[model samples]
Target: MKNRKPLVIGNLTARIPVIQGGMGVGISLSSLAGSVAACGGVGVISTAQIGWREADFCKNPLEANFRAMKKEILKARQISEGKGILGVNIMVATQHYKEYVKEAVKNGVDLIISGAGLPVDLPGLVQGSKTKIAPIISSLKSAKVLCKMWDRKYQTAPDLVVIEGPKAGGHLGFSREELETIDELGYDEVIRSVVKLVREYADKYKKKIPVAVAGGIFKSEDLDHALELGADGVQLGTRFVTTKECDASMEYKQSYLDARQEDVCIVQSPVGMPGRAIQNEFVQRVQREKLPIRRCHHCIVTCSPKEIPYCITDALVNAVEGNTKEGLLFCGANVWRCDRIETVAEIMEEFQ
Candidate 1:
């Protein structure tokens, strides 16, 4: 195939194999994602409460969310000069899950990467759109089941597969007990396992399924190591959070700057998934129950108001708004090393 020229694996086209990990709550918006895509990498916009600023969100969630999603995609596409691929990361647990994916497809999003849940119906959602669909998985078993199910039901395979290890930020893949038991565990084994399974499916279907690995990958060496170990590409999330182009507040960005190695700890999310985040006053307050879920945003579907300790949406929004004292700050394991803010070019240069 003559190397395939490193075109975008999903629906978009990029000059390089690097795919920007999607951040949310206005973090990886049009400005940041467009710039990265324009720079020759796949730029991803997070569809996580992206319409948060829309005045009609609270009153008319679906209409407002759809509108904002369309606007963001168009904005990102325009800013990228129509170069590179513009993709979206939509969590499966969010309210109106299929609606969000459909909205992205309707808006001409190039690709959709879903996580935080199985997203079993992902293929069905993008049935007629030209958008490519990829589900994020953590293990070989999960990948096999999803691919098998998609193949059987939709006669389609994942355009790409993202194997996120336990060290990733936000919602986690395993139980707290499991994550703790394997703390600091290298991802090579899991990556190889998932890649092996993906290869089997690829061979059977006579298609190429490029495997991308994530979680705790920070520097050029880390990327090189993954590539050497069979990863076709890499997904970097936490490292980009500190970039000046990131839409996060200065306080939030500074939190990463002030973080220590020990400060990055695994904590329980209000949605019941184990997550890695910076140990800050907000995290401590949640651990101590000093801060409570004052208002209900009804963001995630799996969360029960009584069982969940707090409303994740409100907490995260608070952090994006710069209320570090009581906000929820989600980050990957390498967040502690962020010491300063720089441009995406500088961040990407480090990997070069």
Candidate 2:
């Protein structure tokens, strides 16, 4: 194994250069995030419908989410015991996106990773806070646009940047058509281009903007590949799902253990984006016909309850709760490679 350097962003540092990507809808919560952080890696909690289990969630989802977000951040801090980094992943498309950012900042999270859309106002949102901001982008074009906009608007650059490719899980940045022919996309070249562009901006701004690559980053070899491509770190989501400390139910983890390469497929999410997931009964049924939307959780900004196929929140909640038959199991392209459950410490040790 090669010696790896720590991941540094502003004043914060992670002993390991691996970030546990944020999985949503009760999947990656305090338990998972805190565990990873304790292991000297950046552990991220997804703020997507994070308050699903709160008693007031059904009636006052936003308030419930705000309260839960604060509690989760505090709990993760306690669990981390002052080690590594704790960050929150807030989707730009989520309802009350600004409020969620404020809540995360107010809770004093170490970092904020935003995606699912370009988080153009993120710099302004976290202006005076010690919380670092990173944007999740898919292409060089988007990266250039974001850097230019942030530099021009706020006189600042991203503290870190995450490049999430087509193989990533849940609410991807690519079009459905583009994802279908992803084999011909030459995404590695894109990664290199984005890395080079970010380096230029880093030089111009006179600061370090560490770049991390997400999607299909499953093992130690994959981490080496990303570093070889000029990335400072790797962000992994699916690889952590089967971890013993992950917040998802045992049955949800089993879905990954049972998955085969052929079982992974792309699906159109109600959030108006393409996502990669294990093709289960619920996914197949949605592809065949539109399922009923019992009620809207008001999760995302683009979701239209009456016309959409099904509620993403409901499906994800089901998956986290162990209803594999009906839940939407969002996973990375390499999920099939997962064979067993391990602790966060064990997974972090592999990167070392």
C-alpha local distance difference test of each model = 0.80, 0.92
Q: How good is model 1 by TM-score?
A: 0.94
lDDT of 1 by residue, 1-352 (tens): 1132454474356665667888877778887888778777778999888878899777775677678888888888888898777899999999889888888888888889999988899999998779988899998789988998988998878888998888788778988887777744455777888888888878877778888788887876777777777878778888888887887888888888888889888888877788887788778877777446565555788888877777777778888878877778889888887877778777555554
lDDT of 2 at 209: 92
RMSD of 2: 1.2
To one decimal, what is the Cα RMSD in angstroms of model 1 from the true structure?
2.6
| Regions of candidate 1 where Cα sits further than 4 Å from its true position | 1-7, 183-186, 290-294, 350-352
Q: Work out the TM-score per prediction.
A: 0.94, 0.98
Candidate of highest TM-score:
2
lDDT of 2: 0.92
Candidate 1 has its poorest 10 consecutive residues by lDDT at 1-10
